[model samples]
Target: MSASKIAIGCMHLLAKLPLPLLRGLGKVVGRVLFVVAGQRRRIALRNFELCFPDVPEVQRKAWAKESFEVFCQTFLDRSWLWFGSEELVRSRVKLVGATHELKGDTPTIVFAPHFYSMDAGGLALPLNTEREFTSIFATNPDPDLDRWFMNGRQRFGNVKMLNRADGVKPIIQCLRKGGLLYLLPDMDYGKNDSVFVPFFAVQDTATIPSLSRFARLGKAKVVALYNRMTPEGYVAELTPAWENFPTDDHVADTARMNRELQAAIMTMVPQYYWVHKRFKTRPDGEPSLYSGK
Candidate 1:
């Protein structure tokens, strides 16, 4: 079966558990991964070492480990928070703007970082407000566990899943209808399609197509939305940017937009910088943050 089918099924079953139970389960999974999974540990460590070169090696390593642990804990907590107590999820999040919606033939774009609990980020938006949008999602890592999780996302009133195979039509149609659409332009889908952009002054092969394609095709308002972490609740901010999006030169424009994306994401939550491979695919002839004594 297709990925959308599996994700849709697995997550549904997981959600059936009590919220507390899910939280516990997630904690257990995180702890196990931290202790047993060395590859991701290595990735996190390497990424951090590069991102924060000025910090002492020891300090960077320590923060990366702690960040990984936190990442795992948040992963579990988010699922529990989203499925069990919708209010708690909403409580932690504060929405900034509302002028754009999936109302008619005008599409609105929402950019969220894979920084926080992406699952929680998904729910927080639609659940917090009575607004609606068709959010795009990458295929699940585990095909066997797809169904239930995908369904959980769909539980929110607004999100319409845009699978990798057939995202174009639905996305455009949704935007044309004045609906909101979400996508993450961080991961590299293909080098041929990507542009090397400066993320923290380090060039990364980032996703430029999503924004470029949307900007090229749709006349919708392109808004940069980011969720900032705070002591109390998340500060979700919205800022409107160039719409035609400098479609003149695909590579340069894409790179510029990516740099802008990095700036916006950093502003959202400075702590998120502790964990991602934000500068993974750097430009040739440039020394990588991953390199050090």
Candidate 2:
């Protein structure tokens, strides 16, 4: 075989090694990423401070370390989760409080944040009797690479995927047909596309306005769900929408709901907070998050 081909084959073999050794090596790589490379640490550090302004720097660092641990567990066990049999996955994950409020024949919209093992919910699909997931996906390149992702996730019983650009129409159609569509409401989209919501009293951004607009226009049931890691594995909880939930002022309502969700996120998942560049698109005149307070 060619030299490059042999090198690539060797890497593949290493990736398939025993879980313990693979996990150990993964830690080494993560250290390289966090300490040496500092890829997302800047934002992680910034966010930790923003969220815990009163806490000491030492305690903030503790939370940051815990976030790394959670991420490590999720990343190392990735292959096992994707390829493991249905029984194995079902046994690991359990859903609680998936009440009737979560179900109904309407365009149901569920806002699921990126918990440490949030995607593990995909494995718990067939195991669920209450609802089937039809995902709204942000498309990426590489069909062959993404095939395994689809195989693990797209169970095809009632589950579906939508390319991000064309996601709106399908989601609206699903609502009209009385189906469920999931969206990640926490991530920033762009200027005017999202608004600065008071998350932890800081101007954190979110995309739930799209959800609010969808709900307002389609009158879909807006549900909040989270997949949190438990000692056994993970559990999905359906937090019913507030009584007389916002229907009039969508932008304002979206911001209010995101604040409520952020509180839930802090309580359930202190770590694996899906630390992202939340303040990158700050409004004009706002202090840059990168600068030290």
Candidate 3:
């Protein structure tokens, strides 16, 4: 069998085990990864140092290591999320607030940050409600893996997946038709339609201004959503929709999105995706943060 097939087989096997067992195994695997993945560990440590400079180095290192373990748990949990029984999945997830109120005529923007269990939040909303869903997914380079991942995401309901390369027409149309747009806008995607914004006191972070546009085009309400793991299972929490969003200025709205994202990330410190180079793309003539120069 091919390597990818073998990996898929292992994921299926992991899916068969209980969540607690998977989490335990994930911790051991995560420790090994933290040691072996030198670059990722460095990047994660650096992110912590940049974001929380007030904290001591020892605490930052501890948070980085714990973040690795939580990330691995989420990675291992995806197989079960994809292939496990819906009843089983439903039993494992708890909706903390009114996430099922998709009855309104206005389109909704579900703003999800990069928490470890963010996928759970994505799955929870669609599974619990009958709202037609739409989301933008980054395509994987490997064809087989890409197909598998897409299938997993769309398994629950009528979810329209847009390729990242595809422009905004389809998404805008979907929103105009009162579809829920599940957006994860925390990552740095270079400087195409993005503007430099402040994230966790880091200046010049590239952030997408699409949220403001979508809210305006669709007349949507922006709802903050996040999922975090607890001893019982996962909690998909939703805040009350924002009142005065998508004002005349797109830049201010983009900054507001980042500020809300920062607050959400604070609720689950270690579960955030710190391995990403959030500060890699510096402005004008600034130096690279992760180049280790």
Candidate 4:
């Protein structure tokens, strides 16, 4: 069998295990990653250095370690999310806020940050609610993995996953039709449709202007969604929609998004995805953040 197939088969078996057992295994996997995943560990540490400089080194190290464990648990949980029964998955998820009561009339954009279990929250929405959710899915390099992701994300059959390269036309149209868009706006997608914004007090952070633009064009209401790992299970919370969003100033709106993201990250310091090179694309003539070994 191909590597992807073997992975899928393993995950299928893993999915049958109890949540606590899977999480215990994930903790072991995380400890190994903390020592061996050198580059990613460095990046996570760098992120903490930049974002939480006030935090003590020992505390930051502990946070980074926990972050790895949470990330691994979320990673492993995908199998249960993708291949498990609807009742099994739904039982493991607890809805914390007004996501249960949201009406599908107004165009809704659920702004998801880079939490490890963000996909769990996305999966829950379409499975529980009757609304159709649409989101942009970036194609994976591995063909098999890409197919798996596409199939898993749309398993509930109420979602429309568009390729990221397909541009924003489809997303805007979907939102205009009053569908839910699970928009993840925290990545550094370069300078084309993005602008440098202050993320966690870092001025060189690259942020896309699409979130604000989509809200205006589709007449969408923006709400924050957080999926967190608790002792019982994953808790997915949806804040009420923001007021006076997507004003005439796009940059200000993007800044507002980042500010909210910072606040949200504060609530659950670990579990936010920190392995990415967020500050890689520096401004004109600026030195790189991850330069030294």
Clashes per model (N, Cα, C within 3 A)? 24, 1, 0, 0
lDDT of 2: 0.66
Q: Report the C-alpha lDDT of model 4 over 1-293, residue by residue, as the tens digit.
A: 79998998899999999989999999999989999999999999998898878889999899999999998988999989898998887888777787644574689888988899887887878876778789888889889889888888888848898888898789989988888989998888886778898998587688987889989999899998988888666888889888899898999999999999888888898989988888887788988888873
Worst 10 residues of 4 by lDDT: 96-105
Q: Write model 3 residue lDDT over 1-293, tens digit each, in one string.
A: 76777787788888899888999998988999999999999999999988998999999999999999998988888888888989988899777776545666578998888888988887888887787888899889887788878888888877889987898888888888888999988888887888898888687788888889888988888887888977556898888888799899998899999888888888778998999988888787888888772
The candidate with the higher lDDT, 2 or 3, is 3
Residue 67: error of model 3 in Å? 0.5
After superposition on all C-alphas, the RMSD of every candidate to the true structure, in Å, is 5.0, 3.8, 1.3, 1.2
Off by over 4 Å in 1: 1-32, 97-105, 128-132, 141-144, 204-206, 228-235, 241-247, 264-293
- Could you tell me every candidate's TM-score relative to the true structure? 0.73, 0.84, 0.97, 0.97
Predicted candidate 4, C-alpha RMSD: 1.2
> Which regions of candidate 4 deviate over 4 angstroms?
none
lDDT (Cα, tens digit) per residue for candidate 1, span 187-240: 645555566666553445555566767755666666666655444435566565
User: Per-residue CA lDDT of candidate 2, range 1-293, in tens?
Assistant: 55544543444565455556756665566556667536567677788787679989987777776666567666655555665556656766776675566555766777677777767765554456446567777654655446556765664346777777784776777667777767676766667677667766476554547767777666777777777766566787777766555568777887767776777777754445546766666777776776642
User: Ranking by TM-score, best first?
Assistant: 4, 3, 2, 1
Report lDDT per candidate: 0.60, 0.66, 0.85, 0.86
Backbone clash total, candidate 4: 0
Per-residue error for 116 in candidate 1, Å, reads 2.1
